[model samples]
Target: MIPQTDPKAGYLAQRAEIDAAIQRVLDGGRYILGEEVAAFEREFAAFADARHGIAVASGTDALILALRALDIGPGDCVITVSHTAVATVAAIELTGAQALLLDVDASYGLDPAQLEATLNAWPATAARPKAIIPVHLYGQAADMPAIAAIAEKHGLAILEDGSQAHGARLNGIGIGHWGKLSAYSLYPTKNLGAIGDGGIITTDDAALDARLRELREYGWRERYVSAISGMNSRLDPLQAAILRVKLTRLQVDTDRRRAIAARYDAGLADVKAISLPRTRPGAMPVYHQYVIETENREALRTKLSERGVSTLVHYPVPVHLQPAYLGRVPLGVGGLKRTEAAALRVISLPMFPQLSDAQVDQVIAAVRASV
Candidate 1:
């Protein structure tokens, strides 16, 4: 079976080198927060064009730590997109801050107009959100230029959620470099997958970086010495080694994804029922999942499944509806019209660098036929 076409296949296409790297980690006595993790952090930071990088245990932790580092806590609010992984909103709630939801736009990122309108009407109040967290949804970036402008006017900090886009670029620069602290996930299926769970935060601020480094290790400067209250979440050496190996070919792999996306755009152009993703002139989508929208999405999904083509909804529910976050997160800013609309229509196709051109054609045909 083809399974979900994953970059792991491409990585395994170069498996011998990856195996040796993992073995080297095994040989080293130190495991957590070792040389491999350090190197990967530095390499990844450079890849994102950020000055400081901090390795963490998971994507969720990355966001939580980012909130902690930003000092967003009880009684504070954080404005962000509703059309994002629950982890994004959950991270804010987990930090004792309120989650304020905003809708998305045509690009399926944040709707900057809606964001500004909400802030203009709501005016933070006693729940003044100290920050704005926008997702670079499905390898596509939100309009950072507009969001940055709004944030500046409202005096809100920006923390970009870049979990889906590893090497994704926006307006000539990478996603992680757009805001103060951007979070990334290295879940196995990501564009730059790790063997297991891993995450990182990239930034140019040295003081925040140093503090985060200390914060991940139980606030310890050395063994058994607690500098402050912190969590025990650090990237494993093995995952780091695996990621280090994967990092070498990230851009090349991203290019292959783009190639497939281009084919989909060309081949599936006539299918009027489907709405394809849009890329900014200077931005590049890593095509993490090739999310598309259709009116009869459930029918389309069932048909796709019957045809031996696997698919998933990047998210079926907006963050507001999730049970885990009830009472904590606000009911969302007004209607969240775009957010709710996307929740029903968006579907994630089998996407990865290893997905062949022919497979892309098969996917296109399947989608076209279904529509």
Candidate 2:
């Protein structure tokens, strides 16, 4: 069956380069945060058009560190959407801050209008709203211009969660440009993925850059000296080496993903049963997962599987509705109506750079027949 996403395919596509990177790391005695990790950090930072990059162990750590760097914890509230990877909310909570969940727009991003309304009606007794983590979900940018304007008015910091949006842009600028700092997950399935679990944070602020480096390694400005309270979250050298090789090809890969998305758009436009993914005006999404919404998601998923095509739900349940956070996590002013709707309907079709034109046609055909 065609897979929803193929990380292994990514490896196979560049096997020789990846193997050489691994060999290079093995040859170098230092296995931890060595030259490989340092080089990847620099390369990725340049790619993101940021002043600095701090490599971390996981995407969750990237968020946590970004929050900590900003001193957002306990008695602090961070606004983000409910329709996202659990890691987004989990990272905020891990940082000891309260997560105020919000709704998404039609493009499956944070609603700027809701953000304005929520701040206007925010209870005085509630945790002080300190930051907004606008997740660039599905590699599509949130309405940063509107969000940034609202943020500026309210004195809230913007921390972009660009986990899925490696090469995405809005109004001629990168997704992370509007925020003070941005966090990205380099998971095996992400656009600029590492071979294993990895993450990175980028920022234009030199002070934040230095603080993030210290925070990642037990507050180590000088070795073995605990300068401040921090945790251990360093990117592995082996993964970093592999990512360096992958980084060189990200733009080409992103172009291929866009091509596939265009094909899906043409092929599935007439399927009345499904709503195709939408791109915002002046935005260029990298198509991490070409998701479509259909009320009969489970039925359609089953049908596609039966027809030898695989699909997966971007998120089967909204974070607030999940058992771990139910009845506890706060919601925005109007509640997560759009987020809840998306959870029940959205399903991600097969999406990856390696998918050939013929395979894309197969997926489109299967989707047409199934829907």
Candidate 3:
């Protein structure tokens, strides 16, 4: 069956180069944060047009480190959507802060309108909302201009969750540049993925950059010195080398993804039962996952699977509704009606750089038939 995502194919596409990169690291006799890691950090930061990049062990750690570096912890609260990978919320809790889950807009991003209302009605007795994390869900940028204005009005810091939007842009500027700092997950299925778990944070603030470097390695200001409390989340050299190789072809791969998304859009345009993904004005998505919405999602998913077209839900449950958070987590005004509806309806079609035109056609035909 055609898989929803194929990280193996991603590795195989660059096997020769990847294998060489691994060998280079092995032969270099250094495995920890070394030249390879440093170079990848620089290259990736430059690609995002940021001044610095802090490589970490995983995408989850990227968010945790970014939050900690910003001095957001106990007695603080962060605002974010509930319709994202749980990692986004988990990272906030990891920083010892309260996560105030919010609803999303049609773009599946933090709704700027909801954000405005939530801030205006925030209780004086509740924890102060210190930061807002606008997740660029499904490779589409959040409504940054609107969110930014609201954030400015409330004196809230903006930390973009750019895990799914590696090369996405809004209004000609990169997604990572919209917030004070942005975290990206380099999970195997991401647009610019690594063989294993990897993540990075990008920022233009030099002082914040220096603090993040220290935080990723036991708060070390110098060798074996703990300048402050931190954690062990350094990016290894082997993964760094592999990521560097993958970074070179990221733009080319992104173009292929967009082309595939366009094909799906055109092919499924007439299927009234399904709604295609939407791209906001002046926002360029990388199509990390070409999500389609339908009321009878499970039946459609089953039909597609029966036809050898595998599919998966980006998220089957909203974070706030999950068992662990069902009654405990707080929500913004009017609750997550959209988030709950999306959980039951959204299905991610086969999406990966290695999916060929013929394979894409097969998916399109299967989806058309299913709908």
Model 1 collision count: 1
lDDT of 1: 0.84
Better model by TM-score: candidate 1 vs candidate 2? 2
lDDT of 2 at 18: 98
Tens digits of per-residue lDDT for model 1, 1-371: 23455555866766998999988988887787878899999999989888888999999899999888988888888988778888898888888888888788888888888877778777444655689898988888778888989999988998888999888877887787667899988888888888789999998999899888878889888888989888898999998998898899988988988898889889877889999888867777788878889999999988888877888897998877678754556644466788888899998888888777778788888888888
List the lowest-lDDT window of 10 residues for candidate 3. 119-128
Deviating ranges (above 4 Å) for candidate 3: none
Please give, for residues 123-235, the per-residue lDDT of candidate 3 as tens digits: 88866799999999999999999999999999999999999999899999899887789999999899989889999999999999999999999999998999999899998
Tell me how many residue pairs clash in candidate 2.
0
Single out the weakest 10-residue window by summed lDDT for candidate 2.
120-129
lDDT (Cα atoms) of all candidates against the true structure: 0.84, 0.94, 0.93
lDDT of 1 at 217: 89
lDDT of 3: 0.93
Off by over 4 Å in 1: 7-11, 123-125, 326-328, 331-333
lDDT of 2 at 217: 98
